[model samples]
Target chain A: MAIATDARPQRTTTVPRRKRVRRTKGQKAFAVFNYAMFAIFALICAYPFYYLIINSVSANNLSALGDVRFWPIGFHLSNYGQVFQLQGLTLATAVSVARTVLGTAGTVLVSAFLGFMFTQERMWGRAFWYRFTVITMYFSAGLIPVFLIIKGLGLTNNFWVYVIPYLVQPFNIILVKTFVESMPRSLQEAAEIDGANILQVFFRVYLPNMTPILATVAIFSAVAQWNMFQDTLIYITDQSLYTLQYLLYMFINQANSLATAAQNAAGGSLSSIASAATSQTSTSIQMTVAVVVVLPIIFIYPLFQRFFVKGIMLGAVKG
Target chain B: MTTQAVLQEAASSNLVREQENTLKRGSRKRVGGKPNGKKSIGMFLCILPFLVLIFVFSYLPLYGWIFSLYDYQPALGLQGSAFVGFQWFEMLVSSPTQMAQILQVLANTLAMSFLGIATSILPLIFAVFLNEVKAPWFRNIVQTLTTLPNFISWVLVYMIAFSLFSSSGLVNSVLTDSGIITTPVKFLDSGDHVWITMLLWSLWKGLGWGAIIYLAAITGIDPALYESARIDGAGRFQLMRFITIPQLMPTYVVLLMLSVANLLNNGMDQYYVFQNAFNMQHIQVLDLYVYNVGLTGNNLSLATAIGMLKSLISVILLLTVNLIAKRARGTSII
Candidate 1:
């Protein structure tokens, strides 16, 4: 009589017993082969990072000779100390971090706003405006014209060049639009019926549902902003506006000039032994700088990984 | 008889419209006066800034194509520059050597793009095999590691390449120490197999990231298909061969179409970073060539002319692909 009151008995009573299926030898063999292949491939993908990390930590002489592979030989933090003292690196890192944060926030908000607006059929001339926006996705004005525009706009050597010129990206808009369209109509309607205006409905009802797509768009923007050097290469000659990637690029290009750069950065008072140590090969400087450039990406990558696959799926499903 | 019937229909519809208008006006008053009109105008105002921005950025640049029709002088400015006909276009093909150089660049662009298309199938195969792995955690780890390369800049990739494959780098050191070869290989410095080297480098950077769409598509495949195959004594490989590749074909085809539309655009970043005096002859794609001609060579007009042709051809190709897609798939990407 008390059986009806039991809470945990529903599944056992209604459902069939599950059966275990034994795997064939062929399946087992394939599984082993697959796992082995995955191990090797993963190792291949991760090895360059490992190599750079090991060499950056190891002593200059052995690493510069390429003898520090497979393991770190002489562990030291001197390279980090030396790298930080390079002029403009601190400023560049700050600039890069600022651009990444500001640029991502600006782009995500713009994309979300436009995406939500494009979905509103009641908006005046929505179709024409939507097409006008989306058509920019197909083509681009070539390098010279783009450069001329930026120069005309006085973005050259300006910090805002990193932010302003890319504010209205069509591809991001399309992704956001597609994601917003996939959301249930009832949610927006419910909010609107409860006396919410358009912006209120957007911020309250839609923005909360927009986290995954926004995360994806944020990743796209952040990575593009963080990894951006071409703009810096062309627009900004001012050392104060140099980005971390651009500074790293300068290091890689003039690896042999590191001693001069370090000495000059230190105001030419570097002692003999330190100067001698700083005369390490281009490989050491290159690897160490490469580590600095890649460290931010590596640090934030795991946090973004969970959302990327889901985000990518949402984008692809729009197709 | 036809006129009378049409007039009757119109009269009835006009009456219905009048009632609906009254209902709408009542609701408008309830909502504090002309809500839809005000709301629509508000929305338009919100997007107006974006429209102006896109116009200035995207459409405004078309005006620069006129520079190719002018004798560009840096100090004179675009306005003060002398107007010329299509002299640059004529000069582009006027000489045999100039024509030959352009041809070679085009050839390199086509070769690289073809190689890219050929390797586009690798991601599909990768995704197929990757899906067969049952452990979600293991699959995720492999995916995260593999996708790491795509997130980094091409400069970083080149740095990694230098560290791993430079003359005194690890590979050569290992090879020479083992006495497999007496000398270190000129992997990065040599001009040999430049296309293949570039392709491999791109694959290293893009393979796992490229597999993402196919993997997503694979997850969307029906589970019943696999269950039925299992019941029918079909093995895993058979099921994959029959279902997986075919199911992924639409996505693959769409990507391929987009790539084809972008045939001339072999992106310059990887090639630019990897360029050396040794590989410069083979590595100079159209974009890089245009850049060199404009800034380094100081032939901005000629560069603009070439870039103009490239943009025109690309837009035409995209339209062609859109038409084909519409015909075949009943939907166009554009």
Candidate 2:
């Protein structure tokens, strides 16, 4: 439906174009100025990541001294090694990865299913169910109540707890519904004429047409799950079940141990090295942990970026 | 016409009408079928997973609020817990020490959230400006850059703030080296600066992602509107002010309502990352207060009570705003 509205204006504009209007000299200069401003803004945004990545790889003293190095002063994997050396890094990383994958898959599946059901022409009480889901989207049961509920269920430290609670996201359901609602009713009419049942029409016919929106929802859910830190922080009491973000939290809070550890870990006096190793005063280790936690998001960003662009247009074009 | 032929035509027409009626009735019945017997079983099966989640995590725990009336202890394990109805609330609300702390935390949270919104509004405007440019590639690149920060976790954000603004960090180093100031400012640890820095950190994280929706709405405005305005001698500023802003109002209203509804949600994780004892007074929010009392302080009942109060108030506020929007402007958020 949203796409139809968006296409409506473009459809009218595609007639043979009028001759280009002559631009004033000021307009040409202003366009150049706009281009320059945009380029500078882009550079400022990208520079921080460049700086962070370069600094994360630097050797001990360089990391602590906060040198303005655009390139790595002394590159080594030891910082990453130090990050993984944190008590529960491996388990936490694994748990977070598993939860995110399953959680995204589960949320997309349920939301898509509900969306399809809501769009069914013959589905009874469709409006009631639609309004119920919308209310849930807008009115949460509150965080404390949610936490209390999690505790009462004995899922405080349980593995299934993480994915189960967020298996269905209401906002995603609404977005998918909007997409399905806008689909041509003629398609469903054709399927009915061919003796297709409602379930068959939905699964075999409509779902295939829903690929783009499904991809959009999948990406949104996955990104949200990947960045989920708050729930795990509150509910997961056991340190072993910590997610990547929580592990990073531990490192950030323990910043005093971070500075000298980086310096000595790179190379230092025996006493300093002993103090760094035993005292664990290395910032490099925390930097390493930060790097590990952030790497996946950085790499896969461009792929998801496309879907986000498409998704943003879907909502507004309708209204 | 033969009498037999006329009779045959009438019979066939009647048969066609009967089939149409049956099909219509069948669809209506299926759509409105009651959930009972075999159909009830199917409905239950269809909704089993959602039910399990809602029961285990939402409904059951609502019953668990009974503990808030007790001095809950792990040794007592809820059953053996001592009942202390309104005692914790009294201690919190009546006592000067706890009451003052709570008020301060509330004040801090409000200031942080308000300041964060004020600071981010400019970036949103900038995003609108960027959207007006006809260069697609440039717009995409700029947008990607701004949104990249949003994806970085709060932990990384904290690290960046410390590295840039710490006493020994870049900002202070430049200040001292350039003789702009004789001493390095304590950007992270100073009590007065914490709220401001906290808001800045949030703005930095959310600037790009926040603006994306507004920009999308802006782009949705018909290009013909701009053409009309241009023909009418409307300059860019006038066009934006009169046409674009008005068109974007509904989207803005919805976004504003969401932001206001989420006012109490100060994002405990970001503040938690940035907090130190030195600036604790300035940085504490209601959510943080609950975390301290409930999780770290191990005063489970008190924490739950506080959380319950906050949630109730926030929900009330949300509903009130939503109702006002619906009644006054005909824009219902739900």
Leading candidate by lDDT: 1
CAPRI-style grade of the A/B interface in model 2: acceptable
Q: What overall lDDT goes with each candidate model?
A: 0.77, 0.66
Report residue A107 deviation for candidate 2 (angstroms): 1.6
Off by over 4 Å in 2: A1-44, A76-78, A81-87, A120-130, A184-208, A256-281, A317-319, B1-41, B172-184
Q: Name model 1 segments beyond 4 Å from true.
A: A1-29, A182-197, A200-205, A263-270, A273-281, B1-39
Q: Could you tell me the lDDT of residue B87 within candidate 2?
A: 88
The two-chain DockQ for each candidate, comma-separated, is 0.33, 0.30
TM per prediction: 0.88, 0.82
- Winning candidate number (TM-score): 1
| Candidate 1, residue A105: lDDT | 93
**Chain A TM-score compared with the true chain A, each model in order:** 0.84, 0.80
